[model samples]
Target: MLKTLPADSRPREKLLARGAAALSDTELLALLLRTGTRERGVLQMADEVLQRFGGIAGLLHTEPTALKAVSGLGGTAKRAELLAVMELARRAAAQQLKEREVFSSPDAVKRFLQLHLAHKAHEVFCVLFLDAQNRLVEMRELFHGTLTQTSVYPREVVKQALALHAASVVLAHNHPSGTVQPSRADEALTQTLKSALALIDVRVLDHVIVAPGDALSMAEKGLL
Candidate 1:
């Protein structure tokens, strides 16, 4: 099918002639896929895959097992490539945070969290541990819960913070309901963790709520 298009209009040619930014999402994805199933064109399959996962942001959080279920990515090679690319994107974001004070680029922090937590079928609570200079030291998923809620233990969070020797932390959790607005329970848990960590002299910098393609910063809202 790609062969049927003009050479300048084909994904690879267009990417070479104009640059990757000029290509549509479907064209970029089709370039990665390389080939299509017998019944579908690569462009069509790529579009379907994007739609199935709710676009590129959702695809970033996709698990390997889920990739296998997609007919277009049925081959191990294809799935592995996709997984590798997603992992690389996450690591790149983490590296950026590790190199600078996270607050210096508020949007980078949210993008990093979204790459790690968004588009999940259930909830996840994670922490971004930071050094004295506010550079990211590490990120850990401390809790996983059902569709609506996760039970986070303040003691465990404090313990991890102590172990990591982190001076502060950015608390984050995802809402499967696709809402980044913090709930009352979310607010309560933030205060509880803030109190628990204060005893050890670790500050709670912010609480971020993540959903598919979106994130909210409680600090920006004066909720922290």
Candidate 2:
């Protein structure tokens, strides 16, 4: 199929001639996949893979075990390449947060949180510890399972904040159900952690809710 396309229109040639931004998602993914199985063309395989995972954001969160279930990705090389790209993307986002104020680029914060938390099958409560300059000090998952005021202890959060000497924090959690809306319990837990961190002069910068392809910031919503 690729051989039949115009030389300038193939994924590799199109990218070289027009820049990567000109390629559609299927074309870009085909460049990464490189080849196809006996029954499918590379472009068709890439399109099916993206559709199966619900597009790029969902694909970024795919696990190795999940990839094994896909047809062409059963091979080690393709799976490894795909996983490596995802890890590189995650690290790049983290590095960006480390170099600048965590909130300076609100989209970056959400993207970072989504990479880390959006893949979980269960609820995960994490904290982004920020230094005095508001740069990322560390991101740690403090709780898992159903998140509630009772399940996520404020004292434990206080302890970690004191240990990291964080000046502020961004609380984040994933909703495996795929809803980005903050529940009543989510609001209460944020308040609880905020008051606890306040005793040690640490601020709660934001509470971000993430799902596979979405993120919402409580601070942006004026809920914090």
Candidate 3:
């Protein structure tokens, strides 16, 4: 049935005619999958993938091994393709971060953090080191913790800052429970990090808490 559709209405052709932004998720996925099985059309298969995975971010978060269990997307090659696509997206985000002056483009930093932290099943503490002018020097995942908590060492963070010659830093962590609210511990930790970094003339610009859907800035809330 998909093959019989007018060429202009097909996923690939439609994408070419109207641009990628004009395509729906299902249509974009159909272009990636390329073909459907005897039992279903590519468009139908893409819809099934979206339904089973809970959306694009959910699919991106899913392990490649786990995708083997998905009905239509069973082969290792398909899973590898998905992983490659995700990697490309991550690299693109990282490249964008590298090109921009940090803090000046707050949304770019948020996008980089969302790609790294959001949808993660466990907590992660991350830091972005910056020069005196706030251009990004580097980003690191400093610690990992369970569903609700992560251990952060102010000393280790300061050590890294010194090594990188960073004059400032932005802190971030994810709440797997999908809430951007910072706990008292989060507030305390921010102060501790701020004090420690201040010893070396480094500044703490913000502590962002990433949830599944959004992120919040502690500095903006006067918590830092």
Model 3 TM-score relative to the real fold: 0.92
lDDT of 3 by residue, 9-105 (tens): 7988888888999888888888888877789988998888987777786666555666788776787676777788988887787777667778777
Comparing 1 with 2 on lDDT, the higher-scoring candidate is: 1
As a TM-score, model 2 comes out at 0.93
Candidate that scores best on TM-score: 1
Overlapping backbone residue pairs in candidate 3 total: 0
For each candidate in turn, the TM-score is 0.94, 0.93, 0.92
Q: lDDT tens digits, residues 19-117, model 1?
A: 999999999999999999999999999999999988888788776788899986877899988888999999999999999999999999999999888
Give the number of the best model, judged by lDDT.
1
Local distance difference test scores for all models: 0.93, 0.91, 0.85
Cα distance off (Å), candidate 2, residue 7 = 1.1
After aligning candidate 1 to the native by TM-score, how far in Å is the CA of 201 from where it should be? 1.4
Where does model 2 exceed 4 Å of error?
146-150
| Tens-digit per-residue lDDT, 1-224, candidate 2 | 79889988799999999999999999999999999999999999999999999899899987678999999998899999999999999999999999998878999999999988888787889999999999999999998885432278899999999999999999999998888999998999899899988999999999999988999999999999
